[model samples]
Target: MNTRLLFFLLIICPLSAVCQTFTSSNLPILVIDTRGGTILDDPKIVADLRIIDNGPGKRNNLTDKASFTSVMGIEYRGATSQQFFPKKPYGIELRDSTGINSVAKSVLGMPAESDWVLNATYNDKTLIRETLTYDFYRKMSKYYASRFRYCELVLNGEYRGIYIVMERLKRDKNRVPITSIKKTDITGDAVTGGYILKIDKTVGSTSRSWKSPYPSGPRNINLDIQIDRPKPEDLAEEQFQYIKKYVSDFEASLAGSDFRDPTKGFRAFVDEQSFIDYLILTEVCKNVDGYRLSAYFYKERDSKGGKITMGPIWDYNLTYGNADYCEGNSYMGWAFNFSRVCPKDDFVLPFWWDRLLLDLDFARKVKEKYKALRQTVLTPERLGAFVDSTSSALTESRQRNFVKWPVIGTYVWPNGFVGRTYEAETDYLKTWIGQRLTWMDINIESFGVLTALREEAAFTLGPNPSIGDVTLKLPLPTPTDVSLSLTDMQGRALQTRHWPAQPKGLFERTLPATDFNTGPGVYILTISTQTGPTSRVIVRE
Candidate 1:
């Protein structure tokens, strides 16, 4: 056993007997026995793991029968967390009876997987930062996010406080849902996909990584992309070169002058919707480490929307007004502008976000998506309920957890706000979210030339697939100044007409098709009022 582990057990074990014995829990109970072995950063030690889950609304006790039991190879996880925090997180791999062969079994209600993470959210006092962020991302995007369950852990007779057993991000049908690649898949379409790459600090990662061809955001910092799936040993040289070149080409295209060109530019290389959704989530939370660190991107087979897509966001413990640095606590400002905010930070946000916003269509889509989400998943009422329910569920478990590690009312590094109680922490989180949402609503509009009006009923445009001239109708409630403009799909202005003081109720104008020299394509017809701008798709036949 290492000196640190030995010392910890020696000091803590003797004192634990005097403390309250953990008897029962409202949450699931995970008990692990290391069998006198020490848990290190690597070269996992053999451990016996058992889980006791009494289902919802039932109490789980240490004396109860275990629902699942297995031999597991366990090791300490996290880079800075392992170094700084005494309450350690763990990475576990299930093993068979021989303790050598791998095994897969469903733990709690999650899918059967051998690889798992026991995240000790020690820095996060509320203990719901990752859970809340993942849940919100899953609700917002169609992509798969990690599923987790909160539980109490007892390691070698020592009650180790609250930990979340979460699905580790990897290639699985129930997880990333991408094509599986092999060493033999070195040619044709097989060589093209499914690669999972992560941009992160390489402190403890053993995965093979490559530096980006482009500098990150006006800085000389080179972003490193690590291959997260298909272990480096299993990958062929051709496969490695192919993915590397593919990412290189994407960067080149995005940086090119024709980047805005839909067919030939960056648009063809990426899934725009995924990027937009990622932007919204990161900005909404004002994640300090977002975009630059722990960022993930994946590509599937060419047949399956082959573009590089941003997704499956990870490590957001420093998000939602959590961190004190880089304006993270502020409810205002964009997270994508991290380079401008911090400038000298080692990790820098890529230039993709700034470049993407240059496209009017992409900006419009982002605005529309944000507006839609605000009406549904992101409302204050819905979010507040989530926080409340989560807090209520952890009511019993939290007391034991706090007792194990009394961090409340004390300052942990990078904490934006230190609340005296759990209630205060939750209340601060809720208030920050509400303020952040409002700030984003007002700021996101500056992305493009037009700010979308709240009321779609303000104007109407018809004969959409117009054979000739199309009529635009505006039923103004009050006399208003309006400017009507027609533009090609590329945003080149075709014509503009202005009325200084248009009379109220039913004003009409005919937009002649002959005036649009551009033929047989989609066009944008925008109406600019004192309130805001509203745009509609007008097809020229």
Candidate 2:
């Protein structure tokens, strides 16, 4: 065959394959040009980039004065991802003519940002896991979930399949809203807060990390956490010590006997709502690395919440029935229990969640939030529609993507295969999600309620931070002897009442302020049943 015919057969002829399902690409085309055709593993290397809209009919066309930028990195997980495949991810940094970092003009109507990621969908056949996961978090009102736009990529004049141009997670007014740390402001309130830390495996420049004090799994191993902001060199000694000490104190309180204390326990150092929301998202998807890796938490200024928040979820390509290992593809079990199943894994989840699950209050809150979310965000109809719309958007571009890198009918690393073709892959995702949501819906409602301790126990306390009188209520699951104990912050019982063989009904009692010490502080209220002990925090004002 002639060389020209070979070139046409391989590149120019879009429909060379007789079984072509789509003839036209309906997503924007991104063209990247490297000076020496060298995009390295390092994020700093720069290559030029251009945008050409290829969607149906036409959209905003690039102008003559359209600003462009530099690109770097071919693999997303740095060098680790390169070992698996030839095609890799890339990073784009918008720059002005003077080579200074600047925001690029919005492309395909995406928000303007200085940095963006062109993720390679090599591992994920559906090519929508990350985007869909982010969509779920954003809909659930997660703080600063990265927004993304889908587009086709051509690097060094070669087609490189479908890619998503997503906002990079960082501290900025438009991103993670938090106080910016400066080396100059080393003392006092300036250095006390605002830090982003990640629980992940050690890699690259992020080697400057600390190990957890508590051993997590059966191996008695501690996980490593990396500081994302305030580069180690730029961080002051006091700032470093302050953050370390704060986390250490929080961990100490959480592991202590009085871990349920509202004033000095883990609740005081972490945001409750944020934790619940994170748990729902992670558990719903059964992310293999949910708490073990790619887990992020941030702390703000003392005046602003003054607590750590788990947020801005990252890396979900291996989630949502995607992974075959560690029971990731299963629709059963809780994501928080991954450590119990895979304890010997190098990176394990902290025991924080395990301990939290033991707390009845936290479990109840999770159930409540999950119940509310199911009606709106996690509903089967709504989730199915979202997946349908995403598949429709990729209908035309998917053919081109498959043509560029044909892995549809093949296995990639850790996939729990359900089908082969693009349509089959997408159908698999939709069906898996629908089934997963159903499993979660049924399980979450009965989550902590069906514990061996009780079948239908109802507990509530009102007028938190009570002034003179406090009310405690308990609706027992079965007829049994129960004991109510009121204690000070130090776990010393102040008042105790015993009820012999109480029936399965609501029990209400009022504690007079005169019986307790006269002052403002925190106290513990415990109701011990034949099954187990239920605890709550009572504040006396």
TM-score of 1: 0.80
- What's the TM-score of every candidate structure? 0.80, 0.77
Q: Per-residue CA lDDT of candidate 1, range 43-133, in tens?
A: 8999999898989999987778888899999999888888999899999999998888888778889999898999999988999888988
Angstrom error of the Cα, residue 168, model 2: value is 1.2
Residue pairs in candidate 2 whose N, alpha carbon or C atoms collide under 3 angstroms: 74-89
For model 1, the run of ten residues with the poorest summed lDDT: 5-14
For residues 300-366, write the lDDT of model 2, one tens digit per residue: 8787777888876888888888889877887665677565455446787886786676666777888
Q: What CA root-mean-square deviation does each model show from the true structure?
A: 12.2, 11.9
> Native-vs-model 2 lDDT?
0.70
